[model samples]
Target: MKNRTAVIDLGTNTFNLIIAEKNEGALNELVHLEEGVKLGEGGINKGNIQEAAFLRGMQMMKHFSGLLKKYEVSNYKAIATSAIRNAKNGPDFIKQVKVQTGIVIESINGQKEAEYIYGGVKSSGALSDKTSLILDIGGGSVECILCNHSELFWKESFEIGAARLMDIFHKEDPIPSEKITELNRYLEEKLEPLFEQCKIFKPHNLIGSAGAFDTFVEMIETEKGNDVDLRELKTYLFDSIAFAEITDWLCTSSHEQRINRKSIIPLRVDMIVTASILTGFIIEKLGVKEIGMSAYSMKEGILSKLIR
Candidate 1:
């Protein structure tokens, strides 16, 4: 097995990279990089990747390329999901990435993405043998997987995500009740089939990974206090305070405000609401009260493949 491997997740909203090494059956994180590309910010609405957004992504890749060279990374894999999958020029974009940075970004479908999330969760040692539902919300899509004893019973991905939802239904500041209603209706319609599929699985617990769950942990550790466990995050009530605080903070803040705020930026903050909403709904709809957060996901999957 390769001792060092790098995994890059070219996400719709953020491009993330992790350089790690595996030895003695343990994987250790060595390097991490992320940038807000907002690749899917308006692509879902326009059905094409705009020049500005495409250029932003290119610049981010170029920067990442420099970092990879600096670290002398030899075995690395980069994959893009959702946004690139939906883009009309996604093929051209991937070709351009290879030409520009020498990093080939493979476009993966939703089911495959869910499989990677499942791989990451199973490695976390937090999952139980009983039925568990894994929900991973990205910038362009959400994936839900039901598993027991590390085996997947069902999996589904939805087009709803942080940046996509924010662009589609989140026009009003602090998000008006009417907008929330419309969003819920849309989610219900889309999630109903998956919910029905989940009914057969009857998951004993729900596990959340990536995006909003990451922000929730950041908020709790930074705002609530230190010594807070991931379980405390599951106790979140999604009250008006959390909604208003997060929404108001995301809507009114600019780059300068986030520079010194000592919190995860507003871009990540923007997705937290949608993440929380989905989380809140999953708990109520599935009747599972406990949700565990695993910070690892597609990156780990990539590493697993490379190391093996």
Candidate 2:
């Protein structure tokens, strides 16, 4: 049997698993699964993992562990991000998971997270000779990396992720206008360094990493009545106007309305509004002319390291 490896991404809003194996110098994924555990539901900004949220995370862990055993993974690695890394009880929760499941999860720092996001975006075949600013919108943090196919210029991670934004500003279902303005201003202040780097690099192409971007791709395909399986491509360059329209629709949608969309993932329905605002802020502020989506993200980045 091929040496199958499983990589787990333990995020604030979701837990994703991918099982893959190397074959003749190429990496082939065998299975992929995502669970909406909402590990930060009640306590992201509060700096603690609530009992309910902790239970949800633990349940997902057991589910993933079961799958790992069934697949008989030859190797496995789990990386924990924002929620687990930032929570006051994060270490305790990690210890429990290790004792119960025998799986050790490493909580990565912001700088290292940004590097992994860059690696995944690079493998997605999104960057051209022209530089690209890559954004990975996570539940508890957003990672920004400025790079091209051949060089890396700048990168940073911000704690202003969608879950945190939703916790802070999403009081109204559709999100009030003033809240949107406030969120933009807050982003401007927190992400001034990213703005400065964009000015220096002058990268017009904005490549968004998978997660929220995957939802964007599905929504676009649904709007056009296209049946294309987006998973087939590592990268897709979106039509800027279509993307802008979708962003507006998402921002104006109420919770009930967003939940009804066939294309929007249930886990993302509540945060996509915040996520759209964040994406729109960057596009407008940086004069971004091109928008692209990479099908791969940090999980693939970790897998790349293993196979290499």
Candidate 3:
């Protein structure tokens, strides 16, 4: 507890907690946990946290507080992202969370969120000398960073997260072809800014940071019967062909089918389809030829800052 530090990322769809400490001159992670609290489940698009979700968030904070105590973590930071920042009642919710669990929530805007995401991806060593586009798809927003190994060139956070998309375009069980078409069309319009940046940077490698990317890496590994211990690696290389195939499968699968898959977590079962569609859209529209997955993301990025 003396030297250890922890960071919590309160995303729209999930709450992530990571505890880490430096050992023998190297940083090591003690624990990383993600809880599907769905804080913005019923009222995200409406710019509010429903009564039930508000109460639910309080419970999760108390639970997370217990974990922090169990791990003897005294130094910790809790970051609230799109869900809380964009919601009309976000500040009130944050206040209640502090009062309930003694955890102060630092809410951040989209731009700052994108910057943190860049830092997280940079730590993974996924960015190369050449240029890479990093995409982090959360529940309330999607962050796209255009950068490379040495520096981050540009970044923007768009409010088209998987959960947001689910609320907008999820009209059928399997998502009809027309609905897919409509969703893609809508995304094309909203992501124009990112596409413009891509043109200037001409990034060929698309790096996905945490969340759905983690699931993709595991799902692909499981598909190939390769039991690669993800903990040992900072980044996982993705074959474009394999990724495309998986994207197609994911976009067409039903909730029941997705729920049965061990790689697809219960929290992501309903939103993965939209997330996959968004990733696929980016890969195709931006002409990205290579894909890489970073196991580190916002929480990991902030943990570094906390330790500093």
lDDT (Cα atoms) of all candidates against the true structure? 0.74, 0.90, 0.88
Runs of candidate 2 with Cα error greater than 4 angstroms are: none
TM-score of each: 0.86, 0.97, 0.96
Task: Estimate candidate 3's alpha-carbon lDDT, on a 0 to 1 scale.
Answer: 0.88
- Please provide, for model 1 over 1-308, each residue's C-alpha lDDT reduced to its tens digit, 9 standing for 90 to 100: 34567888988888998887776887676787767888876675566788888999999889888878877777888898988988898888899989998998889999999988888767656477898888898888899988965588898888887678878776655667687778778888989977898778888777767567666556645776654444223323333355446544644554445455555666775565566666676677777756667766777766776788
> Which candidate ranks first by TM-score, i.e. highest?
2
Strongest candidate by lDDT: 2
Q: Point out the worst 10-residue segment of candidate 2 by lDDT.
A: 226-235
Q: Model 1, residue 172: what's the lDDT?
A: 57
Using lDDT as the yardstick, the better of models 1 and 2 is 2
Q: 1 or 2: which has the higher TM-score?
A: 2
Error at 278, model 3, angstroms: 0.6
lDDT tens string, model 2, 284-307? 998888999999889888888877
Stretches of model 3 off by over 4 angstroms after superposition: none
Candidate 3 residues 88-148, lDDT tens each? Answer: 9999999998888889999998889988888888887787799889999999999999888
Model 1 clash pairs are: none
Shift of residue 122 alpha carbon in model 2, Å: 0.8
